[model samples]
Target chain A: MSLDFGLIIEQMPDILSGLWVTLWIWVVASILGAALGFLVAAARRYGPAPLDWLLKLYVEILRGNPFLIQLFLLYFGGPFIGLRLEPIPAGLIGLTIYASAYFSEIFRAGFQAVPRGHVEAAQCVGLSRSQILRRILLPEMTMLVLPQCVNMAIILIKETAILSIITVPEMTMVIGAIGSQQYAFVDAMFLLAIFYWVLVEICDWLGRRAEAKLSKFRFAVT
Target chain B: MSFKLFELMLWAAGYTVVLSAISIVIGLTIGLCVCAAKLARSRALSIPATVFISFFRGVPLLVQLLLIYNLLPAIGISVPSVVAAVIGLSLCTAAYQAENLRGGFNSVPKGLLEAADMVGLSPWQQLKRIRAPIALRLTLPALVNEAILILKASSLISVVGVIELTRMAQNLSASTYRPLLFYSVAGGLYLVICWTVAGGGALAERLTRTSRA
Candidate 1:
């Protein structure tokens, strides 16, 4: 089949709107996930025993199951809990929760990689626990966390496509609608793939650049 | 509503297990082949194999599932939805498994191959007797992890209307309007399956460690 530049151009604006929804989903999910991930990481690190156990269980439950199932639970199950969320909100919540679990593990890895000697040195200088955490631990952890975080972000972005199943107006949903409407299944899907590819490539590029920047610090440390 | 939800959960759980098992078997076989081809010396074979691995690895599984389930029929091969889902999952899982197996292969010492050759072993015998056993042992942990990942990913098959665990949860929620209870149960089942797989991986790792010592 010949490539259809004309059809692509014609569909560009509509696809852009769908892309906007996808971007919104990614941005919201990333922020919430990062926040929740940090909290879980901190809890697992410094919280009391019961809280640590709870956080551990939360992380395992979220990581062990598929995001699609979590999406179903939230989109369909929220109503039974007396909180009826819209499709977009439900999808975002589910993705955020799922992403948090993965990111928390990444965060924990980063935190553990921070040498205990460094924290001990900070203590020698009379830095309080909170001060050491804020000043030394977090700055060092960011370098370790950023690369994996960016990779997870790409995964989360692609995952948003699954939300289309719950009637969220993301890019995949748009592709599905267009395919059904115009009987342009192959064309619409090809376009959709391009959209996702571009997003993933951009995220990967950013991740590599960040990793490069972080590695320079490693050289200085050694 | 309660009884119906219980029935749906049981039914869906059964299908999920069956699908996961089939995909794992197919995926492991194809993955080993692709991994071997990738590690082969022939540029002609390795280059295409590498490209195939990257193509599947790069795209999301959901998109691949859609492409296989919805788009393939238009190209004249009308696979059933279940078949398409299985193929899509197996293909995706194989790409990951191939990468994992390549790591195991790389861990095999070059001296072993030379030793096998000095003993007048054929290439096939060297691979079967010297390479496969050690590689499989080293890679067992990673293979188990991938199995769990594939099992969880199989839930995506429900998108094409396979009556798997996730789909059953969706159907039950709609029918009973008791979404919380049904979904929680479905989610619980998934957790159990994954935890069991993970526990098995840990056991295998421990056994391997003891054996090596």
Candidate 2:
């Protein structure tokens, strides 16, 4: 109930450093996740019968388990298996894998959303498969993918808080350390919540802009 | 893993499922009310609902858990870790379920309500016959989705000292020095539980469809 803004201001440097860590994790997770997702999505879309089942199983396993457990498995289990990893790398790998599962679904849906007729039309016009994919499919899929990717970006930002449970020096952990040290429990938590809120709101705003652009794409197509 | 170890994991996962189910049920009830408020004509009723949904949705559940765990001491209400965990999960899930319910209800056509009104149906009858069923049906898939997410998220309750499945896995692995075995068991348990939930949801949907038909 008693919030001291001055206390928060005093702890600003620590909080800012925590924010920096969170930002880098978010960016790396997004890039790595998106890369893995595109690969999985492409394989799922184009690969033959047996590979479909294997790829689907990979996606299912990741989706079914919680991110925290995944992190524990990597952070703790990796060393046992000779793949020794630091906390930062373990956290990053865990998040990237988790994000890829969710992102792959989005990417798959984006691919599916592209109209089949357009691809057929491109083929009829003598465009090669890769050319058609680049020109027609990629453009249309980007319209759908951008907004969803933005959404996943927001989710990933919030999820980085979970990394703190594994001792990843993120904002949430920093806020906790500050809160208990200064007994500004309420103030520290309030600030932490606001930090996450602003991050998500920015992502949401960008998503809306992308969504608007998508509608314009559709408008132009029509 | 040994049989005893696997059994321990199963037992821990059972706790995970029970905690998640309790919270999900409570969240569904709370979500119904919040959804009702969000749909209400009165701004006074709707504004608080909006705030609740926004605050809960905007903040990550992990932070919420930590905050609530700490908040109880400040408020002179000392609850056990399990209680704190459930409260955190329930409130957080309620926010999401509320949004899901709102989305469901919003999909109910205005024309349908107008028709009900023209037929002189009372508010209660209209809600019972038209609004509730349509909304629940619309919300079925989302409800299932949220349930699975909460089940997975229940892992975070370990931070509050509930020692749920994931925490149990962490401890067992750290102690036994067989991280691979314990973590794999934990992952398998989660996957099993999730699929069961998903299968049940699919069954319920099918049953409803057949009964209607």
Give TM-scores for every candidate, taking all chains together and pairing residue i with residue i.
Answer: 0.89, 0.95
Candidate with top DockQ is: 2
- State the lDDT of candidate 2 residue by residue for B73-145, as single tens digits: 8778999989999999999999999999999888888888899999999989998998889889988989999
Overall local distance difference test of candidate 2: 0.89
Each model's lDDT comes to 0.84, 0.89
TM-score of candidate 2 to 2 decimals: 0.95
Cα RMSD for candidate 1?
3.0
Clashing pairs in 2: none
* DockQ values of all predictions: 0.54, 0.72
**Candidate 2 lDDT, A115-163, residue by residue in tens:** 8888999999999988999999998899878888988888899899999
Q: For candidate 1, what is the total of clashing residue pairs?
A: 0
